[model samples]
Target: MKHIRNFCIIAHIDHGKSTLADRLLEFTSTVSERDAQAQVLDNMDIERERGITIKSHAIQMDYLLDGEKYVLNLIDTPGHVDFSYEVSRSIAACEGALLIVDSTQGIQAQTISNLYKAIEHDLHIIPVMNKMDLPNAMPDEVEDQILELIGGKREDIIHASGKTGMGIENILRAIVHDVPPPVGDSAKPLQCMIFDSVFNSFRGIIAYFKVVNGEIRKGDLVKFMATGKEYHADEVGVLRLEMEPRKMLGAGDVGYIISGIKTSKEVKVGDTITHVKGGCQNRVEGFEEVKPMVFAGVYPIDSDDYEDLRASMEKLQLNDASLTFEPESSAALGFGFRCGFLGMLHMEIIQERLEREFDMNVITTVPNVPYIVHTKKGEQVEVHNPSGLPEQTIIDWIDEPYIHAQIITKSEYIGQIMNLCLTKRGEMVKQEYLTADRVELSYNMPLAEIVFDFYDKLKSISKGYASFDYQPIGFKPAKLIKLDILLNGESVDALSTLIHFDNAQPLGRRMCEKLKELIPRQQFDIAIQAAIGSKIISRETVKAVRKDVTAKCYGGDISRKRKLLEKQKKGKKRMKQVGNVEVPQKAFMAVLKLD
Candidate 1:
């Protein structure tokens, strides 16, 4: 155990965390030179194509230092804020972290957020500056920033370029010298923490865990502390690029256990596993459960695929514990599932995966944050859909979720960014200058405002130089009203949304116009209107398709042409009175993207 190092890499997005992991694997000879690939830990095709890590991966390496052998377990984590829950789980299983900062970009918003998480875990942090090979590398400035953030001496900071493999050896030596070895008691009863799990078609549920106390071996009976279900360990192994069977795993070692569990819900992440015989007197402390912040209803384009969608979601959820879903039905979209996700990006990734991996075409409604509705009878209910809200007469008031947001950007664009924030109903909390050219702005705002298109707009306003991060601050009182979109005369519940009363008219108007553009012309006139209860706030019209009713009366009298036109007009009027407007699926999605 003295020669074992358990650590992970944490950083902001695009900060070379994966690249550094690759170099470390290469330097330690974990993967052969001929078999090595870029972003080896990021095994997902989506991850490789997007050049980002979406899932946390663990690998074990054997490194020889000064003719002495040492075991190094490195877990690579996702950098996006949406995957913060995944990052926390990975951190809980390690004893130390490599805090990588891009020298050219200095410190980003996510960098500060992830650093706080590492500090919360009380892990030994080794701050390293990466991307030193870039021409615009500002190691000196970034090093000063790191010193201020971590309160370390200048000499303590390590410099490395993942592209050129510079200072890779020093990084390994620093990990062995600075990061402390995992401390646990082997004599105690078995205690392990399940940081991650994956479902295998033939092997069942494979749990990735770190042994916290005692030892676990094949055929040992283990019980999940949370679920209280017992299972025999079918296999025990360590991850070395791939799973390699091991006789047993001792305390402070990271490995995988095949428990023959069939479903992920049975072997959840952040659960404790211990010996069934009660050798250990206590359960390991697990991380807080992940709660999704965004909710959306996803339905198959074809109603017959509903069962297929459910099956696909179940399989996907086996690997992603953060995703939550339940049966939901829409008046217009038919039966489907209302899914919860960590954030917008997380939701997008899931939708993309369902389509790409499962071959299911799905239509998703506008994303919403859960709202607390106080009824006239003094009862409070949480509503995830606008249609689920109570009537206006029976509601006393409604509360919406808010977030404390942080923005880091160049000083020159602060004015534009602030204006954009103000339009989204963001209140300024504080603003300070990190440097003469860089500034950090803080705000308290509704989570709904930013979840839609706020990030895209912020990037456009700042010319792609601003970085943003936010955390939920809980529910707050708000004057919000539900805006319903009506096609012809019927309300489309799937298009209903809750908006602040002050901005309802303009947003409703924009939505109606967007719907008008998206909905195709029918045989009869179509009326697109946005309403709040009985009040019509905005309206747009799609005229009926015009046909050449008089074209067939060639060389006829003018009166004959008039009679033909009059008959056609009467037919349109009758059709408009009885015909129902058919709203295309694209219309529902277009209104949500209207901003």
Candidate 2:
């Protein structure tokens, strides 16, 4: 156990964490040079195409240092803020972390956020500056920044280029020298921490865990501490880029155990596994359940595929424990699921996975944050969708979730960034200049404000140089009202949204205009009106198709043409009074993208 090193790589998006992991695998000969793939840890196609790690990958490696064999267990974690929970779980299962920073980019928002997470976990952090081989690399400045951010000695910082494999050997040596081996007793009853799980049709739930105490073997009966379900370990194996079966896993070893359980819900990430007969009396501490931060309604484009979509979601959720869903129905869109995600990116990934992997076409409503509604009856209710909100007469107040937003950008773009933030109802908390040319701005803003296109706007205004990160602070009381869209005096529930009273009129106007552009012309004039509690704030009209009622009377008298026009106008008024507008799916989606 003393020769084992369990560590994970943490970094901001676009940094060389995955690349560094690949090089580490090569240096240890875990994967042959001829067969090694770029970003080997990123197994999903979406990850490779997006150039980001979406899931955390674990592998066991054998390395030789100073003629001594060492067992290295490394986990490569996702760098996005949406996957922070995954990162945290990885950190909990490791004894150390490699904080990789891009030499040219210095410290990004996620870099700082992830660094603090490692610190919180009390892991030995080895700060490493990557991409030193690039022409724009400035190792000295980044070294200073690392020291300042982590408050560590300069000698502790390592420099390496993942592309050219420079400093790869030193990094390996550092792992042996700097990182502490897992500390546990092999004689103790079996206790393990599950960091991840995947479903297999042939076998079952393959739970990847780190043995914190004692040992586990194939055929041993183990129980999940969280769910209190017991199962016999059908198989135990080490992940050497592939599953290699083993009879037993000792303390400090990281491997997967197949329990023959048919459903993924039986095992959960962060659940503790222990011997069924005798094990640790208490469950392991520091197991935090993943809470979703964003909610949206997802439905299949074709109603017949609803069951297919549900099945796909179940399979996807097996891999993604952060995803939460329940049945939901919309008057316009029909039956669907109300899904919750960690963030916007997480929501997008799940939707993409359902369509691409499961071959199901889905439509997603505008994402929303849960709101606390206080009613006149002295009752508190949580509203996840605007359509589910109670009537205004019964509601006393509405509270929305807010986040502490941190944005790092060049000083030249500070003015534009501040204006954008202010427009989103952001309240300035503090602002500091990280350097003479760069600044870090902090604000308390509603989660709904930035969940949509806030990041895109920030990038555009800053010319793609700014990086933003945020975390949910808590819910705050706000003067919020639901803005409803009325189509010919009928409310469309899917088009309803909660907005601040101050910005409702302008946003309502934009929504009405956008809907006008998206909805096709009908037989009668379609009045697209935005209203707040029966008061119309903004309105736009989709004109009725004007047929040539007088075309056949071209050679007739002018009085006959007038008579025909009058009759056509009267018929149009009657159609407008009774006709129902058929809104397309695109029109509902258009309201969401309205800036």
Candidate 3:
């Protein structure tokens, strides 16, 4: 019998997980010399440009070793902390994990985290120390860390340069020896877990499921174990990695299933796919739905793109089950989507793809951390969107989410990093020295303060030599206020916000600068100010320049100025005339740009 091996590649973000995947495809002869590229798993243009894998991708390769053909099913997992939950889910689906530790960097925070998760799952661990070709690679030190930290057998660690294709055979032999074959009764009623889904205008919705047992044909009737909503399979096919698609996927195989499904919400990840024999049995456990930690409203720059923007959101939702969005209306932005994400990277990545992939122009609202507002009536309201806030209700208490952050860096800069964390209202929970040269510092930080550029500040203060990672640490009662911007007594849609007191000052300056950059220049003196109540913390002027009227029109005719103003203000009905000056989009945008 041919052994079925299923495993995923695990590594810290930017530690060459995707790069190593491309090499795996080449060595396995999945892609010939005629067709190959770097980071082949990253199919999206934005993913390639960002040099990160935002989603998990899996591919099956047929390898021949010692005159025996073996099937190698590889899952490439994302490395960013924002997508760590998805990474965990991917790990859950696999029987084993290829723990790729950077030879140069040793074990990073994420490296430890992923390894820990893989261990918890009890998956066979195949430790592969990567980047052996790099100048900083210390294979001996990395091996020691793996053996000491993970306490795995020293011989289990496979030293390889994923970039250069060194020690691949050893890694493969380890998989065959350590990782067990897929286990299940192939003849039982169909039972599989939906790992991902995609939308098809022609076929409706296609779900990717791993068949645990039984067989599902093209006409098999299936139901979502969690929702109990039945769906008929129109096609049961395999995704040949980045190549073409296949017709059928058998037990222990990973593939997509097309069905008469309209909404992706119907076939969610972690849902079970079982044949309708007598009654559904062995239903896969649905993953706990993850609550979004960060949120922002997206509006189209051109109102005409509103429908397109909504459609784009639909497409994104189909592939990414973690994303959350709902229709939203703004006084200035009109109709758009209020989106929720796992974290900042997740938020930014979705926004960037909307503009690049869909080619839709979007003006996004500032990010807001989730909060629990206690009403005067003693009922607690969990606020995910600012628009969802109870406008008329009086809030007696408000609690904001906090994060437990552990920063490991050189001991020489321990005091510097600690001072910076304190300035941001972080409470030191623990601090310890691991060695004479390294220290670990932990803190509980307000989610709002750390939401914007916190990572950047950490790197700047650490002199770029430190490693930073954090996880949610529940909530804390906080004194918070919403800083509203008044544009001539009317609150500007882009200007209103809610911020905790401790972050209001520093965030005010950074936000002001970003607004100014995003906003265009105006024709009149526009006041750009950030404040809480009557206290103005930062101010910048959008000096409205006199409108550029041609000095000469054929023959020194200044009447051209009148015609120019009319032409410039023609399509912009949103413009308001304050005296003889016309306020355009640029002016409103300039105020937002103010530092």
Deviation of model 3 at 174, angstroms: 0.7
Q: By the lDDT metric, which is better: model 2 or model 3?
A: 2
What is the C-alpha local distance difference test score of each model? 0.90, 0.89, 0.75
Q: Per-candidate RMSD vs. true structure?
A: 1.8, 2.1, 5.2
User: Largest lDDT belongs to which candidate?
Assistant: 1
Over the stretch 105-166, how does candidate 2's per-residue lDDT look in tens digits?
Answer: 88989999988889998999888899999999988888887887889788888889999999
Task: State in Å the error of residue 111, model 2.
Answer: 0.9
lDDT of 1 by residue, 493-561 (tens): 888999899988998999998988888898888998999999998899998887988778888579999
lDDT by residue (102-217, candidate 3, tens digit) is 88777767787888889888888888889998988888777887886778677778878877898887877888777988777766777888887777778788887788877777
Backbone steric clashes in candidate 2, count: 0
Which regions in candidate 1 have their CA more than 4 angstroms from the true location? 279-281, 555-580
Model 1: lDDT of residue 209: 91
Cα displacement (angstroms), candidate 3, residue 595, comes to: 8.2
Rate residue 29 of model 3 by lDDT. Answer: 84
True-structure lDDT of candidate 1:
0.90
Give the TM-score comparing model 1 with the true structure, all chains together: 0.96
Arrange candidates by TM-score, descending: 1, 2, 3
